[model samples]
Target chain A: MSNDIQDLKQPLAKANAGLDSVHVFAPATVANVVCGFDVLGFAVNEPGDEVVMRRTNKPGISISKITGDNGRLPMDPAKNTVSVSVEHYLKSVGRLDVGVDIELHKKMPIGSGLGSSSASTVAGLYAIKTLLGDDSNPAKLLPFAMKGEELACGHGHADNVAPALFGGFVLIRSYEPLDVVRLPHPKDLWCAIVFPDVDVPTREARQIIRNKINMKDAVTQWGNIAGLVSGLFMQDIDLIGRSMQDVLVEPVRSMLIPDFYEMRKMAMDLGAVSFGISGSGPSVFAFTRDEQTARLITGKLKQHLNSIKIGANTYVSTINDAGPRVIG
Target chain B: MSNDIQDLKQPLAKANAGLDSVHVFAPATVANVVCGFDVLGFAVNEPGDEVVMRRTNKPGISISKITGDNGRLPMDPAKNTVSVSVEHYLKSVGRLDVGVDIELHKKMPIGSGLGSSSASTVAGLYAIKTLLGDDSNPAKLLPFAMKGEELACGHGHADNVAPALFGGFVLIRSYEPLDVVRLPHPKDLWCAIVFPDVDVPTREARQIIRNKINMKDAVTQWGNIAGLVSGLFMQDIDLIGRSMQDVLVEPVRSMLIPDFYEMRKMAMDLGAVSFGISGSGPSVFAFTRDEQTARLITGKLKQHLNSIKIGANTYVSTINDAGPRVIG
Candidate 1:
């Protein structure tokens, strides 16, 4: 509409023409890998987040344009998870004096339990690092993004943060500053996630569960979590199948998802190792050893949801190798 | 001594002979695996338990004789951990009509944190099962052994039972019946265990720790447990290293061990990826990738303990593929 606005568009075009600021694609992730409850995640290889960041003299992070968030994502850089992380990371490494403008293409659905929000935050921070010429490795970049994530999620839970920082299965090293560990992800594994047509706010769903767990139950939960992680790392299919059980969060949260019970039952009957509420709720994920089983599990879950007349979207993604990426 | 005592000595002519009735051996195990505390354990190939069982006209399970207990262990059949589990397992399965005579060879040191008591109970039950001639699978015998464990450890904990029953690295599936799931232990891994000469009674050690855990810490604990198990399953050395850290149990238990703070530092400095308190206390275990690292960690741990003049035994072992075996 104006000459200045049009000029802004020209810089964007030139930046897309293979500049130093390159495009990287980071995938959507699944957090709270079943038994892990609040501290495990895996970045998927497909259907991810794209960020476009360019160097600037503005002395602060700027979200030039926001798309794919239903236009509700904040353009004001200070309030954004991605911008805040980038700023914090830069400042911590004594480079906050520089600045960048990041254009976010938040392709994944918000609050979808597919780690849509975390993916964006991870991508944004990574894009800023590339734009600002920070060659810091993933381990170095983790804390900065985790701090930003605390702002977004309202709690410093690393179930999402660890995977978002480093692809594959992730372990929370420590919670204070969000130290993280990237566990080995399966080389030949794919995930089938079903996003039901529903909404269960993470905060609201989390509050519905009891604050205290019986010591007996707590010990069992920890043992199962250990078993689940061991199953993943050992590539022990039967062990993984059994370890996917979670007694702490799933029973309480599954009540929020319409027909969650029926879907879970049918999926297991159709050969899913296990099924549980994803993140807060309204989404559920299952593990399969091969593509056929994955597809079969997905179909079984969908049929149950459909019989109850609930709409949902299913995704087939391999374990995520790249967490956050950039695009023009 | 008497003519009957002389007869008993002459008949056991075969050095490792298994009696026609039953001969049971339960492998020594490392429980807790650091962050898992009361809920994780794995059987090792070394330091096993040996029990010989024979059919008797007695109305109930009876402990006829005990060797290597240093005159300290209980003689009452119903009160002992091993005998109790066998009785409970048999009673629960509706075979209360049967009777047995158990001879426990307490080869492993009592209160060693190598699950000597559990090994005793498991070995006793195994010997009884062998005598029964029903050829029972592991699932059938779990209840009997678990009940026996409850008698000794106060609360029936699985960090020991699961590994002894199934062998190798194991995850406790549930506590009710003490259900268990065996995990795939990595081929290249080795554990260097340091058994401090000092004693930390399991009962007293458990009491010193806090009974309640905050939800935040609980989440982190479970997260790390899952990560550690995943690391073992995937054979992801990095994840295993990262997940081996503890926030719940170690922080408190470490205070009880003298110079534990410094010992851990020395172990880590010796290239061990992770070091943690074994079971209740005193014994410490370090995880490494290769034999060379294992030796290094063992040497370092011994040296540190000695520097503080804390006498201890150090051992390096791979994950034992073989669990309980026949004595013949």
Candidate 2:
């Protein structure tokens, strides 16, 4: 893999000579989509992370500053997801001799169950690639981003990172060969997301899942997965909504979120096309056809969360087609 | 369901006033297409069954003739799958008193694991509908056809019957609501099918499957399912072939088919896109992009089976798009 990246750098390096600094904004993502647990995800527009990179004459990598994480995130270059992935990217391109300084900015909450770490890592990687003038396919940078995910979370799952890096909806068809598939969706599709301020550790949530499940449920889940993919291709909103039903994960994980079922009922009544917990939850999402409906759902959900004496944040945006963009 | 069918009969009754008899042909189908397990299926061009329906003065459905089944199929209206399903259809349409004489010709081998019974049942249903001038959607008759599948295999699965009735590829996304979704495929897709003359009972094949499976395997299977659906939607033949892997059923069921692995290796070596057991066992299939590759595969597979002292029938044709066509 490193050899492949080095080979690509030879042709593009001359084109990237004059760049000294770069800044990027990588959007937050929702993983474990309904009926698509661990296999599907999509990107949203708000609550992301930003990273600024500067080339230096020094020999290695370092973190110049950190902000927006409430001092909870690591500042060490070896430990932080942002600097760690950048180091790997530099190594792959045979640029370890070239020093780079990274400034980490966590625009989203840590452990919000909305791929906070993934955003930071993808932003850092995107910034480094831009600074080095490597304009290869963005998907080529997925492995470096996944290395950061493995550090943030124990598993190196790609559902969150793939969408955050490539934009749009993606299906990680297989992990062995790292087969990621970008799916088609309606242009008018919008998302209403609510992140309730609650403590639900990713490790605990994962342990609660059953190691084995009935074959009958597996068939139902795969059937729904097939339906969901079909719905995306056909651009049928109604089919996508109906096929979002998830038999596994939600039943056990919903208990961790206060009034998850009640929120789903309210969202459905308010014309949300589909409702499900985003990532591992405390953060939940609903898909809608129009921007008005999306805003309405987020507003109502935010109010409900406040009434329950829980702090929350809400966002309404269409699916993000451009993943990370240069903001500087 | 009965009320729904009866309500649809009022306006189309006059259009069928003069028809006295109808002959229809329903194509054979391959269910459990690789990773699809019980939800995916497609129709083939050849090796189908023919049914001839005649309006008579009698008060109920009666089987007048049975041929090509080698005296194995039942003649009783209540016992035969063709007449039992036809009886159910007539009753559902509030025409239980209508008289119909049916003649079933089993053009394909019985117990070939290639949906022999589904073709006969779908053909009979189509013939009855055409003879009575009920010009409704062919999918409306799926439930009655499923009844025939129940009698034949003891499970009312629509994988075979749906494709035979609706044509092309289909996904039975849900069973409770009986949701069936038609999918798109590459026009050049061709299938090479082989039915080795061996007895692998459907009951035994089903019984061998573990009721409980590891969650990891389930995840892998669903990922492949999503990939396969995406491949079909995108018309990516390579993706479709890559995603047609069956980790759940093929591992255990392949033990039943003699030299299954060897055959798969040979087929792959011959440039067949994908290879797997079709439906259950005793019958296997390979997909290719062109007719020459398909014919070559079937010819080589037939020769291999003959060398092993196993009688086999081979077919090479593109996907059957016009299912259950009227012959007379």
Candidate 3:
């Protein structure tokens, strides 16, 4: 892997000889994607983070500025997910001497279960890649971003970072060697995401799950996972909706979110194909066949939250097929 | 669903007006297919069952002859899987008055984890469909075959029967409405199945498993299942091999099969991509990248069994893409 990275350095340096800085954006990702807890995710527009990088002669990476996070995120370059990822990338390419300065713009809420940390990590890594003139394939940077996720959450997971990096629908096919597969995206697919005004720490949400599960439930979950994959490939909306039932994680974790069941029922009644917690809790997502239905579901969800005396934010958008891109 | 079947009767009768008899063959199936415990299966050639059906004026199904079972199987039509399936088919089409004489040739060993009962059920249903001129989709026959499996094994399941009826690799996407999906099959894929001279009742094998599974194990199993499906679609042999790891059922069920570990190690050493118990136990199967490696593994397995003083039957064949069909 290091050798492969080295091969890209010369070409990348030549390509970016005249360039000194670059800016990139990484979209917010919905992890778990209903029936596929810990293994499936997809990207959505809005609620993303942006990062800007500039070449420096200081011989090390530094965080120059941070905004929109209200000081909730760390400013230490070594402790932050973005800078940690950049440090790893630099080490991997044997280019630690290449100094860089990074600016993080966190546009999403912290601890909202909207993959806030993953967005920063992906955007940071992407921005550094652009500044270094490393025309390396985007996927090669996944490991570095995964390392950053590990720094933030204490365990490495790619479900969020993968979609934020590759876009569309992504499956973490295996965890041992970290195999990720990008699945086909269905046209006209829309997502309705609602973030309630609540803070559910990722670690605490993960701890709520028990160590054992019913074998019957496991069989049902796996069947649905395979069915979900098949549905995506066949482009069958009804099948996709049916395959989105969660039998493993949702039943336990949804208890952390208020009115989770009632909200999901309302979404389904309003024509959403499927509804579930975005990742752990607080943030809920629904899939619909068209943008009109998506908007309707979002409107109803917002109304429901308002009637319940809860502050919430909702967004309706199609799947972000173009993961992260340079901002002009 | 019954109405849908009834609608096919008139057209089926017209199509079968001149036909008096029909014979069909259904290939043996490997259920569970490692990673997918009760929802995945595939067909293989050589070890299969044949059913012959003759239109009769008697008004009900009858089992006229049974071969290769040593009288272990029931002779009564109501008790036999094949006749049970035929009876169900006739009832579905509102053609119970159309009597048929049936013959069962069990070419594969019963209780060998080779889907012996499912093969008989599928072949019988296919034969009846042909005699009645029912050109209805083959998938429509799955429910009838699943009923036959319930009669034979005291539980209803479509994992084996689906692939036996549809051919190639199959996934039972959902159990509520019984959705089955045919997966892409790699042309170079080969399966090596070895059946030891031992009996393992499906019910007994199932009883050995606990009701609950470790949540971590379930996660790993589902991840591998997703990986397996991706591998098949991508036609990646190494990925398929890596994804064939089964952490849920095999550890518990392998205890019923003698020398399971030794045999699996030998097969892997001989270049088999993956190896595991075929369905319940006693019969073991290995996957290989090509026919040559499949043959080599089979030969080594046979020799190992002989050396251990255990009689065994081994088969080397590619996936049976053409499911049940008529043969002269």
Candidate 4:
């Protein structure tokens, strides 16, 4: 649908045309939730990414600024997940001619295994959708967000992006058909997250995991997965804690994070419901039932890391139920 | 708490001692439900076993008669699972001196992969518990029933015995702690079961399965497991049907069952919700939303087997909610 110059200008000249700009915030997410490997994830309230978008008369999308990345994120529009995803979305909706300038603010740490890129990409996609007045169901935007994930990581897994986009816990039951099922969780569930200043590359972290696992271990893992889903539906917190065990990836991936077991023991002893690596490595999370315990866990965990001469950042919040939203 | 001989006689002579005899019927079960191998199972209403137990003056348990087994079952009390489980129960409760004679009536086919042994063993346990006037929680008898499973098969897996004892759908989340969680299912759900007259030894079926599996397949299996559990909780019938897929066991075990894929296709075409090999199979089952569909499925499946000159027994029933009951 090629539009003449006069026709393209007519819509923007109207009194109530689409907004001139949009600002959106998308929350960070914890992927590979314990027993759920590549299948499950949940969103949190704090430590999110921010995106600012402005419509222009110019032809294509471009990255105006990238902050908090410490020169790590790519500046090229084709190389960055945010612009690439926005381009995919624009092309899908036949709005490629509509120009936009994107600014990604990485409020969360990059490569900390806390879905940092997913948050930014989701924020950018949401901003563009709002700018173009596409009010279709947010789920329709999932594939475009997934393209961003594929660009950031080699594999286009939705465990992180689904929750970051949909809010709450989401299960990617099948990737070929892109079946994402939203799961119920306890209302009072709290998460205490900590990112220790230890470098663990996502590519290398994924490479260390075994390609094959014992059948007995697979049975145990699936049983725990069943129990975890059952616990969420039944709202049984204790069962959820008991079922959050991982036999396949954690054993090998934990080696990448320093003092992982020690931190886990400390968290468990302090009455955390369950503790494990958030995403791949470095970042760890503790599930708790109350805000007081969540804050207490983060406090003690930060102290332990400091005692070991390691710097860390911590956050405590309940599960996020609303995904990306407009701020201005 | 040693009872003197004269004291035991005094109690027997009292007006209200223990019952002279009791008879119980325990329902058959389908273990390794699709994606949930070694973890999930559900009980059926028909094709179960009956057991009759009588008090005797002799101070030891004995099997007086074994019927319907085609001269295959053992008569020795120590060798039979029914009597062995009874002996364990008696010892655990300090009732070793109590005497009982057992009669095993195999109402269902043996070695049919439909939990035939589990039914008889559970029936015998229930009968003994009733005759001795021990009206405790039925779950306390699981370990003793598991002993019966160990006698029947080399492994002490609880997938078969758990549903037979607990009734409905059961999940054995952990084996070491013996954690069993009962799950809810739709009230209108029905099962169409077919037992083909073929031999697939449980030991050989187990041996054919690979000791190790690809991690990617494990993830897919667990994703389906989680989805199935969630569907059960949410009472979503369509989701349940979609998630009832097994990637690990079905691919290998299906080779042992004749016309497995054809039967599955026929069932699905007939509007059955899901179809899979029951237990290790030779026996297979189809889940349906209504009794009419279930009956239709079984009728068609039986005719197909007959056309192929293969003998089969077909049944249609809803899930059994009661584990075991005294007949007289």
Candidate 5:
């Protein structure tokens, strides 16, 4: 071994031994953060997924246990997001001989547009990486996790996985080579996320969107995308709010979400900087200047949804800068 | 007199008397800047238009003299881009009663897709603004110049005018309120501009483009636009070059520019960082790392165009950060 490896041998041994079993919590993400469909996303504090990884004598990855999902997820390692990601990770590091058994605790609702699968996928890969004492860069694991997403959603996109892995706001600038840029998060920025008690399958949500868009609308959307990036970099809250108008995807997709327009109007009226459908929504997210306003908007949205008999879960979160973390 | 008026009166008197006839030069601009169709542009240092504004006793705007063009431009103030912009500027400042005789000196070829009309419009308004001692923000004058573009091209777009008026790179964030953001310009960034001797009227150039674009292409374009903006702010030249791919506009509009693909290939092979049809085509521009590379690329592009019996004008310039200025 090289001197560097020799020096790290002590800590590496302790890490591998002590971390025979490790649990990681990966936060939920709001993808397609208004005006940045398929490009931008941010991590929220709650409604995430947890994955537990334990070293085993067996020579391959396996799904030992799954919870919080009520058996909705597959136990097959190849089919499950968490196990699939762990499998990919093991294969990537040429550590297939190092066996791992994964347990997924899906704390977030499935197909609710809260990036439930992405959270589990990220947490599983992160847990295995930690347990194995891997010193590789975190971003290198994105592709493995993205594979998990592809298996779950039938399409590969990194907007959710990126933020769920790196935390804060992230921009997937390009997908071919997967260039992800993590933007500086404003401390005062808060998110009001509302998940109504309705499920919109990712495939169905995507199908509603037109394959073509008017050139004029495309120009407007691109301009806003530029403005949104500028706003995030400059930390101009109002500019961000103004740029959150999604002229391309939201109009068509929002039609599938009940009371979307009403909720958006209410949120904006209550001083929410911007409001739009999150991911392939049934969940809607709004950005606010402060935590208090975020809470107020969330409470009001939930109350309105309840009064209308739609039932909802609301979350008030400042951006989670620390993405997945080890838990005792 | 009010305090502001009292303060301005002295300078106004001196400006009117000392600057009876003001000459202003506005640099030509490359609009759309690949990937950012209709919303992005940057200013170059040479091949611009010059306008002279002289105070007259007549209580209206008049086109006193026109040079460089073979009587193609209109003589009537209402019909000419420069005079129209000047008229709007005077009306905006409530100085319609203050008559002016304008002369447009077209240094760049008309309809060469080098923002020829935009330069003339900016120069004229800037001249009048200087002669009348209007110390207003330069950006506030964008609408007047944009109106000039509308009258000239049958479409009002500010991508060209904003950069020409402000100098350097510009993004029109929103059109309703006309939010133009001046992007940070890298000091070492150089442009290799080659204007082939041909006229592609802006109207004809615009007509060939489709009113709708594939959604997939739009996403790619917007993502690259974000990358380009981030690249500019971070001074990542390679990122800028990578993000300069235009899948939406170029595929359609490039059909109008003769030997466009051949010229683009030559420029790229000769160390051009990014090569594309500038503005509406006929004029092609490329970004390079330094002055030497810029000159080399320009010479090769000119030679290649000449070999095809197409005469061309080549310019090597860094981004012009100082926009419209009064010249002796």
Candidate 6:
């Protein structure tokens, strides 16, 4: 045991974590803008994840505590998505072997389409990066947060991940080497998210999707993907809405979420430029040109979901331009 | 009665007979943005056709005459593409019979894949749109210009028309109803167009394409289309490049153009982020991140085409943010 103790050599730690106070903000994101499937997204600001981290004399990387998760999440670092991402980022940047403590305040729900985990991942990594004197650039910080995302979703999908790191719309070309690009964010647009209280765990929802899509459907999917991306860049609301339709996933997944059709219809009827499942459903997001429409969509979604007897959390927000910032 | 009818029409007075002083700037364009196949394009500044239109007391839309088209373009308003388009634009909006004179300045060659005909169409329609007080929106202007393009190529394809009307990358959804969406313009990217003085008449080129596509290829094409549009929207060069591949028509069409393979290889090898046959080629456009590389590509294309002793014209440029602009 004594010899093995040398082999272990005390787990890696966070550097300069306790030396100062740090705050980080991570943006909410849209994943799978139609044909991008697993690899395109942009950030929104209105409702996002903010963390205020203060360093402590704590012996290792540990969660000082958490709030707003309704005491549902674990405090254990390995089991916690945010804690692990923070630890991973510090270790990769050679900020390891230093003691630190992390305090994450979850502003958005874990399964919300607002990219709750990605925001948290960004916030956690950012908090640690700041505590360590900003050890990495956006490019460098991406993978660390991505690893955290993989832990939560079982596979890496950067549409949401890249935005969480870079704070804009992003296109993920490949996950193997992690090729990602940030797209121009259309000005004056807001994103409205509706998270129903019903839980359709990511694993379960993913399991229902066919492993291989029919090539015909795939092409249509990609066409729409291109169209949607084009629409976003051009700021064409009608085209963006056209490009958001996904015959592949929505048909199957929407069935799992109660009143999905009704709520979606309501949102569209109320002028949502686009609406679709935010990553595997139970939660959804809609695009609006203005704040009034966003609020209207949120209210409509809430009302529809309620009529189905399901409570929902609705946030009418804007694109998250500032990816990760810190607060206490 | 017969004498009165003969006296009434004869050659008709010149529509544009008075002032001859107006600056004009038409933009070169890229029709069919890779995977979009039948429907995507954008106009670029420089290397465009400039046709200055002026007003005259003489009634009816007859050209006082023209330059730069080498007397190849018809003088009859009903027969000329630009004339017909202007006539159509006016008729469609119920603003008919405007008097105008015109001159054409050939900035780009007659058959460069860089949408040479679109330049003429846009210039004429734009001038008319301006002279008519701009009652139509960007969307409405497209059909008029498209009809003009049909004169040059004998068919209306939006990839060229949409961009010519709008300033950025555009998606032509369906031609029947003329649905179009302008996507965002990429930043900091350069484009090099090499027009080998060989003509691949649009009529023959369209015939060369097989009407029925392999479902497999169709699927791939749509997927890439989605990816490509998303790439542009996301501003991901690699994705755009990857998505530029065409499994449908490029292969067959490139065969008709001499040395097409070597030229493509040259463009790719010369650090071009992407390269493709411009419209119905013999002309090709290569893209890069900077002006230096763009020139480098243009030079490579010129040399390659020349080695085979094919006459060529090369233009080093970038994506056109403003499709068709009026010269003040």
**Best DockQ among the predictions, by candidate number:** 2
Candidate 4 has a DockQ of 0.76
Query: What would the TM-scores of all predictions be?
Result: 0.74, 0.98, 0.96, 0.94, 0.94, 0.70
Put down candidate 1 lDDT per residue, A1-328, tens digits, no spaces. Answer: 1332233333333443324454556677777777777777777776677887777765777878878889777778778888888777666555556667787787677777777777777787677656655544655566666677688778766677668768888776566545566666457666778888787777788788777666556777787776666566666667667767777778888888887777777777767767776677687887766778778877777777788788778877778766665554
In the range B1-328, model 6's lDDT, one tens digit per residue, is 2232233232223233323345557788877666666677777666888877877666667766666666667778788777788777666654465577766677777766778778887888887666655533545666677788777787766678678767777776644445566676469878888888887877788788775444445545665676677667667787778877787778888997888888888888879888888888877888788999889888877887788888898887767777677677
Better of 2 and 3 by DockQ: 2
lDDT of 3 at A254: 90
Selected candidate, larger DockQ, 3 vs 5 = 3
Please write out the lDDT profile of model 5 over residues A147-187, one tens digit for every residue.
Answer: 99899999889999999999998888889867888887568
lDDT of 2 by residue, A94-188 (tens): 77777889898988778788999999999998998888888788887898999999998988999999999989999999999778999988998
DockQ of 2: 0.94
**Which segments of model 2 are wrong by more than 4 Å?**
A1-6, B1-3, B16-18
Alpha-carbon error at A214 in model 2, in Å? Answer: 0.3
lDDT string for model 3 (B96-136, tens) is: 87988999999988999989999999999999888877777
* Candidate 5 Cα errors over 4 Å, as ranges: A1-18, B1-18
- Candidate 1: residue A215 lDDT (0-100): 57
Worst 10 residues of 6 chain A by lDDT: A1-10
RMSD of candidate 5 to the true fold? Answer: 4.0
- Preferred candidate (DockQ higher): 1 or 4: 4
Clashing residue pair totals per candidate (backbone < 3 A): 20, 0, 0, 0, 0, 29
lDDT of 4 by residue, A92-149 (tens): 6666678999888998889899999999989998998788766567777788899999
Q: Rate the local accuracy (lDDT) of all candidates.
A: 0.72, 0.90, 0.87, 0.89, 0.86, 0.71
Across B1-328, the per-residue lDDT of candidate 5 in tens digits comes to: 1333344344444554446789999999999889988889999888889998888887998898999888999998778988887887666555677888988899988888889999999999889878877775677777788889999888889999999999999989888977778888668898998988877888888888899788888888888998898888778888888889999889888888778898888888888889998999888899998889888888987888889898998888889999999886
The superposed Cα distance between candidate 4 and the true structure at residue B88, in angstroms, equals 0.7
Query: Which ten residues in a row are the worst by lDDT in model 5 chain A?
Result: A1-10
Query: TM-score: which is higher, 3 or 6?
Result: 3
**How much DockQ does model 3 earn?**
0.73
